[model samples]
Target: MNHEFSVAEVMTTQGGTMCQYTEMTDAARKRVRAMHNWRRSQLALGNVQNGRNNYNCSQAANMYKMKYDCDLEKSALDYAKQCTLTPSVAYNQGENVHVGPLENDKTKAIATVGEKCTHWSTVIRSSEKKGYPGKTVNSTFFQAVKAWWGQIFRNGVNQRMIFLQNLRDKPNAPIAWSQMAWALSTRIGCAVVNCQSNTFTVCRYRQE
Candidate 1:
C-alpha cells in the first residue's frame, strides 16, 4: 500500500568511513520483491483505472525516479540480483527499465480519464432514480469505495467481503453513509476480476 520511494543501495563501513556499495542480501531481496510487487500493483491499478490492456514499465520507472530521485539502473540491478537468488521472485529484466516523464504523464492521464468516466456514470445512474433516494445515494458512495477495494484487494473476493463486513460493523462505523453509499459499495464488491491479461494480446495492442 506504500508507494513512496527511497533510494535503495548497498553500503559498507570501514576505517570509520561509510562507502556506498552494491550487493544482494536476503533482506534487500525481500525489499526488492516488495518494491516490485508495489510497482506491479500500481501498474495494474493504472490499467484498470484506464480500462487499458497494460501499463509501460519504463514509464512507471521514470515516474519513480522523478518522484524519488533514485537511479533506476542501480535499483533495477539490485532488484535483479535479488530475483536471481530468490527462487520465489521472478521478473523480466528487459521489461523493467525506466524511460522518463512524458510516458508516465500519459499513463496517469489515461487513468484519470477512466476515473472520471466511472464517476460520471455513477452520478447519472443515481440521478435517474427517486425512491429511497437514500439507498441510491448510499449505493453511489459505496460503489466508489468498492472500486478502490477491488484494486487494493485484487482477486481476493472473500477477503474483500470480510473487510467490507468488518467496516460496516465497526464500533465507530466510520463508513456510515447513506443507502446509496451501501449500494455503490455492493456494486464495487461485485466487480472483482483477474488483473493480468494475456501477454501476446497486450503486445499486439501496443503494436497497434
Candidate 2:
C-alpha cells in the first residue's frame, strides 16, 4: 500500500533543485517513486547486511547533492530511508538491543555525559539500545526505523522519543515518524529532524 503511494510523490523538489519548496514536479515525483522500487528490488535480491539495509540517509543525500547538485530534500530522503530498512534479526528473534560498547572501548562508546565527551555517532552507533520503547516490540520494524531515524544526527534521542511516543494514541502512531514532516518544508520531511539538533556540529568539532 505504501509502496504504491511511494514518497507521497514527494512534494519537496522544485525546478530540479531543492528549497523550502512550493510544489513538486512530475519528474521529481517519479524519481522518488523509482527510488522506492529500486530499494525494494535490492531487498528482494538480498542486498542487505547485518540484518538491515545499509543504504542510509546522509549517504544518499550527500551523494545526490554531489551527483545532481540539488538537495535530495528531506521528504524524499526520509522516504528513501524508510523504504529500505528492515528490522535486525535480533529484534525479530525476540532479542533486545543489548546496548553496551564493544567491550574494548566502553568509554568512547557509551559515555554521552561527562568525562570529556568525544563523538555523538560513536556513542549512538554503539550505545543505542536494540530494544525500543512502548509496543515497538509488536510493531513493524520499518516504522521503528523511521522513529529512530528521527534521532540520527540529532541529540536528545530519549527526549525526542518521549515526545514522539506521547503524541501517539498507541505505540503504532509514534512509529510513523514520517507523518511529522519538516515544519519548514513545503513537503520536505525530516532527515534527522533539524540541523541544530544534529550531531554533525559536535562530531565535526571533534574532527577539528
**Top-scoring candidate (TM-score):** 2
lDDT of 1 at 193: 9
Return the TM-score for candidate 1, rounded to 2 decimals.
0.18
Residue 124, model 1: Cα distance from true site in angstroms: 45
| Cα lDDT listed for each candidate | 0.22, 0.23
Q: Please provide, for model 1 over 105-141, each residue's C-alpha lDDT reduced to its tens digit, 9 standing for 90 to 100.
A: 2333333422200111111111111211111222222
* Candidate 1 total steric clashes: 20
Q: After superposing candidate 1, which stretches have Cα over 4 Å from the reference?
A: 1-22, 39-48, 51-93, 99-208
* Residue 97 in model 1: lDDT: 14
In the range 79-195, model 2's lDDT, one tens digit per residue, is: 322322233221101111111112312223233311111101111111122211111111121222323334333322232223344433333332222212211112211121111
Candidate 2: segments with Cα more than 4 A from true spot: 1-22, 51-208
Prediction RMSDs, each to the true structure? 22.1, 19.7
Q: Candidate 1 — worst ten consecutive residues by lDDT sum?
A: 199-208
